[model samples]
Target: MKKIVSVAVSAALALSLAACSSKEKASSDKESSKDPVTISFASWTLGTEKEQNLERLMIKAFEEKNPDIKVKIDESISTSDWNGTLSAAASGGKMPDVFALPQIPLALSNNWLMDITKMTEKDKDFAKISKAVRDSATYNGKVYAVPYAQHFLGYFVNKDLFNDANLDYPEYGPSLQEFTDAVKKVTNINKGIAGLNNPFSISDWYPAAANKDMGWYTYKDGQYSLDSKEFIKGVNLAKEFATNGYTYETLTDEQKANFKGENPEEVWLQGGVAVKWDGTWAAPQDASFDWDFIGIPGGRTVVTNDFVGISKSSKHPEEAYKFAKWMSFGKEGFMKRMKIADEKGKMMNTLPVSTDKDVLDEFFSIQDVPGIRTAYDNLDNAIVEPVKIIPGYVDARFEGQTGVKAGDNENATVGQLMDSFVKGDLKVEDYAKQLDQMADQKTKEAMDSLNK
Candidate 1:
């Protein structure tokens, strides 16, 4: 028998959904046509203490609405382990009925989750959903999941830092040269500070380095396309940042410690860093500093979907679907989450996956964040983050990119990295060949699974 219990969202407990809810379950005698069911989900954003509390409260509200259904949400810590967990769950019989999936077509092609094409066809709001997001979730003409939010990449500037340097704040969208000049004008390494420190790590840089349309990474045929011209440009920019002292390619232990001690954004907040390129979520406020946002140069915006899908092994597939739908589209579920996050001083960070006019207005107005609004306004030019969808492809790509750690080639330029990859220096195929090959392999993998 499945376990039945209640724990408060406030009580100290394991971060996983296995913990009980504290909210009082609504007393309802009316029984559903089916037995009670547990729908599990893993939250990618539930890492911080604030996120944990918010996640629990929102989940409890969902349970209260649907008295007949019990929802169990687990917060996964290691993003690296998340895919493995989902794959293992699918292979075993314990996969959560409702869970998160990358909002990429390659991921949807894995065939381990529920399909949402019919739902899309029936919902009038589907017309409002962004084509980029829908296309990212659709594979072979079938929509497999619902996206919860959309995120974009941009430069989060420190208003104080710019002011201290006597530099004018950037407008809505600035060119690469303009951005670089700002970084140079404000940077001062002798003061144990920088104009900006965009993470040199793979996760932080790849999206911006990708093509403005297809992104830096794409797995289409059976290969990869990390060496495209757009990708090279991104790399060059990264190289320039390091060489120009805007970023630290290699931080000493002491420097790293110093960086940790001074919140980089606080550094900007206090007139240290001039700009920080990252997701829309990194804004930090200060009484002494003024800050504003601008779109990244080249009109580049990397939009990714945080999505929900039903597991094939789910015992309550219908209930799971309903819960996932509620989480994405249901009132007081997703919209409430955006409001709560914003009120808590977090970025009302994510753009709604739905096209609800009211929800968009509510979210954007609530936060008044610039980079996010810019992305939404220019979503027509946004491209999905390139991710490999063949079950193990992400792992492979992660290995390859991460193995070539940032700044490993201090003497080499970003152009060199691209040229090396382009010339098959890494034994990866040429750009076009790689994309076509990966796409073919993905198609074959999806077909192979059906025959099984």
Candidate 2:
């Protein structure tokens, strides 16, 4: 009887052990079958409700396609907070899997982003990207990110105002005189309208021509060129807008009161102003009003592409990279994004920077808005804004430095501001010397980082 009981207990123990092993195998297989993990994305912002919803939808679509991965996007950051946010994340080793990267050589050289040059070369679609956009992202010999869309610097004209003033719609590239004359024809203050206007205000002029505000960044040689002849002319034109009463200026208390509605796109839409120089992003947002646009005169029409980059600290680098490529390179993915913008009927001012000839031609062919056609027509002369081309160039030299208000007198001379900055009169260098120094600093900073 004792032998029988012992044998029975041993048999039961063996059965239990076998069951446990089978269950463990099943669990391991399930774990292996599951997709890897999540990634984080950060960008400058998504200001409007429509934009926020569009972003969420796009993210959802991406996740749906990439079921194995999840993306957590943080869009609640102001421009002031962006640098600190990225820096803190980097220091903590908890940076987003992908983030909006700085577009210039200096910020990129800091080594916070994954090198995307190889990816661009390896991917066939890389050939389809805009050269200017790619060049802006390239540091040394490598490209670090893919730019998504083109944001052009152009003038939005109220067609009705132009007609009322017996003026033609602005040409692709008008002369400076032509621009001024056109503005004068359209000015009608009693009707609460101006000839032309932007929020550039007194101190806002210098940066408008050279800073991130205008997208005119570039570097060459060892110095920067914010005070270049071309740049100076640009600022001079801005000042002209003030001096000629084409822009908002406060000569007296009453004038200051009139300058209150500087950004009233509605006013511009309703023909309150003859023109407003804004990004392509403005067109879609002003659907209720009919409008047209022309490229700024004499200067190369500039555009800034929104750059998409991967974070070096991401846990799921491969997936993050794949997602960036999908968003930036895949036809289906990008088209879906464009479709979303089209659906909202907001500013479809963004154009594709893809190397695809079909995409480019189609982009031009689809004239959903008058501004779209005008921009497309002006493409041959298009150049990315100087600020977009050169990173950090805007902040270092142009920010609040040398516009109409730089001299502090409302009636201060534009030439004095230019001479002061270009000549380094405030103690930087002679005007010619200042330009050379800026170009050199920018070039060295960009190339050195890339080589590293």
Candidate 3:
């Protein structure tokens, strides 16, 4: 659930990919032929105390397991600053041996990644992963990424808040109308608790609504159906929540800042928001006021998680490959990392990506039991966020979404558009029209580029 947009693009929401410059190729020389091979890794998580600690433990286990490779860590202090750091690293010939992906196509095109198809074939852990997930990260028959974690947005209920309001518990996959009805029951913004926040990010309700109305993005003849009745219906429902002050759209800037932190789980500690619309990462437990998460009522699951790729500039490709395999799918290393997560009660932040029944069974056993059960139920019919969505047309109407392209500005971004629509500055019908026009043009452009 991280923003994947280009850093050059405004820091909107996630959707971008890029690669290292030629400078990367010049640094293939080894430190010394006699010295133990060293592989450097980079992580956005290197900034957080909890994540950095977890990473150190994982690396420690990996080192102990191999006993031959020494790891160097280059961390980005903030995910917001990650784009600049990554671009600078590639341009400066300092790309790490293993790093998580912010963008996909650019990395694959510029040879920023190593093809790990052979490794996946031989690794039993990969065999446990889903084909859809593996294929989503593939380009030209090569496996460039190993998706390590994935998640979707859902309704996290503060049971006490709901019970106090006399609202019934949400069904696992409630329909848009059903969730809306539930929100109405609990939302009393005058009292200081929002009925809900954005489903995943600011204005993410559009996609969540689309997911609820249709099991996938509305595409007709290869064009996104932004103006479709279902889309309009979804947007209207979100607007209804805003109008009644049942949603985070009603929150003040300071309130928003508190909930938008790196560790937003702290919001639960206060215990006033009855129904918080957030992703899997934010709802990993029930300790804060007897809470639990459920999939978007009647919505198709959308997974956008972290991925690891090996840098082409690596002098030790095999060692880098070994590290990538160990982190993502190697049974011993992966489980050790999972055990650390369990010990520290950080399963939500460090969920496993493997689809292997045995590994997952073991993973579920150690992590949040109730949360994992809900997750398993939700992922049964999940779909990864398609590249053709936000990533496909950052230059067109989605500009503010991926950040400002040369001709784009904030007023026209997906986030801004939704904000206006929700605030009544723009009409839902008009917003739908704007989206439809962009969808048609971008869809054609995407097709043309693909054919080329």
Put down candidate 1 lDDT per residue, 29-144, tens digits, no spaces: 23334566667777675555555565565676678888878876665324778777776766666676777666344344456776668767876666577777777666667877
For lDDT, candidate 2 versus 3, the one ahead is 3
RMSD of each: 13.3, 9.0, 16.4
Better of 1 and 2 by lDDT: 2
How much is the lDDT of residue 393 in candidate 3?
39
Q: Which portions of model 2 miss their true places by more than 4 Å?
A: 1-32, 46-52, 74-80, 102-106, 190-192, 198-234, 249-266, 284-289, 340-349, 355-367, 374-381, 388-392, 399-452
Which portions of model 1 show Cα errors greater than 4 Å? Answer: 1-38, 42-52, 74-88, 102-110, 191-193, 199-214, 217-230, 248-270, 286-288, 329-332, 338-349, 388-397, 401-452
Best by lDDT: 3
lDDT of 2 by residue, 279-396 (tens): 7776634445456666665535566677767776667777887777666655666677677667765444356666476665555555555555555545544556555446435544
Cα-lDDT of candidate 1: 0.58
lDDT of 2: 0.59
What Cα-based lDDT does every candidate model obtain?
0.58, 0.59, 0.63
What is the TM-score of candidate 2?
0.72
Which structure among the candidates has the greatest TM-score?
Answer: 3
Lowest-sum lDDT 10-residue window in model 3: 12-21
